[model samples]
Target: MPESTRERGRVEASRGGSVRLEDVAVRFRTKKKDVTALRDVSLDVAEGEFVAIVGPSGCGKSTLLKLVAGLLKPSSGAVRLRGEPVTGPRHDIGYVFQRAALLEWRSARRNILLQAEMRRMPADRARARTAELIAMTGLTGFEDAYPHELSGGMQQRVALCRALLHEPPVLLMDEPFGALDALTREQLNVELNRIWRETRTTVLLVTHSIAEAAYLADRIVVMTDRPGTVAEVIDVGLPDERDYAVTMARPEFARATARIRDLLGAASAAD
Candidate 1:
């Protein structure tokens, strides 16, 4: 997530984020048999809450996001946004993946406006928003720079801005920063926290980093190895605004990370 921008001349406006999953499951049909990816998973993310989901590899962490994004349907139960069922793909939700996925020909500004163009957002408004998002993500001067001209982190920043263009209530990120170098990943984490705070976007981020989950989320949901189910949900219990250095130095941060590590280790051993 990148920081949100004000309406250029007017006051800052915030958006609501809300997501709910009820007894959801997903099974894939293969020639051999059915393979269940998720089983009996239920969760709720209140408006403006930041939730992080973590689990071992192939635990269906990303699958949960897909269900909410309407990219996949559950074998049972339901997924909802604003209380309405997500029966199909809809534009009200935003999604960002591990890779930047920018079209090489498109400049940073053009890439940010791609979503708006597809959604048929007003021309004047879209241009203004593109400018604002670029500035928000600290891409002010690189607006005209093509994807090939940007670094890995900057490209990902553009992707994030693209996802937020329409102010989607539920913003889903699947290990969006996983591919970057350690320094860049941590830097984006700081930016994301600031961005999320300003926009108040309801975020459901799936990651493998326990510390990252603790650093960014209000709650961390740890899942079993496979056929994922919620093993534990731990509140981060950190301050509203966090500084990585200060937050990590706190005894509570150590306790929280250790607790999640123990849970994940237990889950791994069980598998």
Candidate 2:
């Protein structure tokens, strides 16, 4: 559990946006049987906040993200952004996935501009925003590089740039760094934190890594096994001004990490 609602308040105040899920549930019916992916999952992500969801594989972590992105609909309950229910993909939401999902034929610069094109943004404004994102992700010199021409980390950076190019108010990420090597994943975590701090965009990230969840989130939402539901919500008490090395060394980091690990263990045992 969070130490207290007061501590949760301080964490929420740090992040600037609000995301709410009201008793959200998702079920899929196939030819054979029904698969319950999520159950009565309720969460609140404050404006400009960075929240990470962690759980066992197939535990509906990504399913929950898709619900928020309006890629999938719940059988019952509702997901709201600000105060509006999410009925479909919203222009105000940006999504990044496990794979960079960049086109092999397109250059990094073009990939970033793709979102702008989809949104029908003005040409000149699109170009400017694309330039800004590429620069922000440190891909300035590699603007013309194709996905195949870049490293895994670089490819993900392109995806991040693409997601942010439209300047969406909310970002939905599903294990954006899960495919990279450990060293690369750590580096990108640092880069992601920098980007989030600079943009102040509301982010809801789904990942299975305990350390990654602790390193990046203002609050960590842990879920149960299959047909997942919120098992625990932990407030990460580290200072908002964080750098990878300094923040990870804090005692609070260890405590939060331990609590999440225990929750995950309990969840697995209950399976």
Candidate 3:
């Protein structure tokens, strides 16, 4: 299958360095039958762009993110990162799951430093990075708190800080805020926008929320139902300078959100 115009643009923006998946398909073979989760999925993400993937339940959105994270391989086709085929999990990428997944025994600061320690970053530098991230995520005073002591939003913030501690060029988030209450989700959305702008890290977020996708993405990629494929890629017309008060009320924001919601509905009906 040929790459779409937006996918082509993403490839080009990588300046001869891109992440490409050619005719990617995933299938699980059981004793009785085969289950296909993704089919003919081809996408290219550029060097520094925030792309959100949205689809109905069981539409392979999470599977797609895992493929890029190198946690799962397509039964057919290839996955690559920055011109290199991703044969396994790459250090240049950081992944955040729906849950904060913090170790109960560790303090928030120690949790953030875990990944850095695994990568064998110098102790002094790791400590410095941990402190910086804590401050960045507004977790400064909570550094000594354990997972049980923090609220849902705070734990996720620690996870975000941990993901960025090593300064990975790409960050993959799978519905990281899905479990949060509405108010916390909105607050995190604002904080995430600020963090993304400050770090300039390319991000790919998978979410089921049309509002969340519209609110957080530079471009939203709507996917078809199970045996998922790209349905549409819509650019968010809202200004980069976004605030909850100003941007959410803008006509452009509503239009973008409606467009994506409609696309997702159509995709679901087609399933």
Candidate 4:
């Protein structure tokens, strides 16, 4: 893609302008009860914006991503991507979970190519895209390595590569780096931010780490306890090109993280 086109792809938007959710609620029914997971939740993630969702355990953080992916239906209200209502599983979005979930038998490159196989992408096109992603994600040397041969962080990199193979407009990440050790997680956070900037793909990340959210997101959505509802949405107000060490030391980072921590603490108390 041309540089100008890539720059235009990063354009931001007002709330409810891109990915829109209007008074959404999710309920799960069991034999004995109808359990509410989310209630009256409304949020909008602007195009090319990096948004992070944080809340107490069981606040349906992961469920929110599922809604966007159209993996689950809302019991009330609506979930829309761009302008259209999400009625079923959306193939245009990329999703990554906490675990890499890579096929043990597949090499790193082959694992990423799995996305191409499923999508039936042209062989040359898929290989080119996979190569670009491998280089972009610092996985160049490990392409032939199997999952067990790579580190946890490396495995997650492969998962991210697969997720981005199609270059979807929106990426949904559910604690993609949560399982890594502190050092690895921090490293991946930096890489993720860089990747987002380069690709200009909108991202919605669900995480428990205040620092991680503060570091990566353009906006942070803090939620209440179970029956998850938006408590507050904070604009991070950081430059797109972020230096990890410098960013963590900034007052904006400190303030954002502090408020998120406070909100989570309050939610825990209520729970």
Best by lDDT: 4
Local distance difference test, candidate 1: 0.86
In the range 1-271, model 1's lDDT, one tens digit per residue, is 1222222222222232267788999999999988889998988777777889999999999999999989888899989876778999867888999998899998999998999889999999999887888888898899999999999999999999999999887799999999999898899899999998888788899998888898998778889987889988877777658898898888878887999899999988876
Per-residue alpha-carbon lDDT of model 4 for 1-271, expressed as tens digits? 0111123345546445558898999999999998899998888777888899999889999999999999999999999997778999999999999999999999999999999999999999999999999999999899999999999999999999999999998999999998999999999999999999999898999998999999999889999998899999888878888999999999999999999988888878876
Stretches > 4 Å off in candidate 1: 1-17
Q: What is the TM-score of each candidate against the true structure?
A: 0.92, 0.94, 0.93, 0.94
* Candidate 4 lDDT score relative to the true structure: 0.91
Clashing pairs in 1: 3-195
Residues 1-271 of candidate 2: C-alpha lDDT, one tens digit per residue = 5333434333453322367898988999999999999998988888778889999999999988888888888899988876688899777888999999998889999988899888899999999888888888889899998889999999999999889988888999999999999999999898889898888888999997899999998889999998999999998866556888888899989998999889889988866
**What does candidate 3's lDDT look like per residue over 1-271, in tens digits?**
2333443233445533345677899998899998899998877776667788998888898998888888898899988887888888788888899999999999999999999889999999999888888888899899999999999999999999999999998899999999999999999999998998888788899997888888888778888887788787787766655888788888878988898878877776765
> Candidate 1: deviation at residue 191, Å?
0.5
- What's the distance in Å from true for residue 237, model 2? 1.4
Cα lDDT computed for each candidate against the true fold: 0.86, 0.86, 0.84, 0.91
**TM-score for model 1?**
0.92
Order of quality (lDDT) = 4, 2, 1, 3
Clashes of each: 1, 6, 0, 0
What is the descending TM-score order? Answer: 4, 2, 3, 1
Off by over 4 Å in 3: 1-12, 15-18
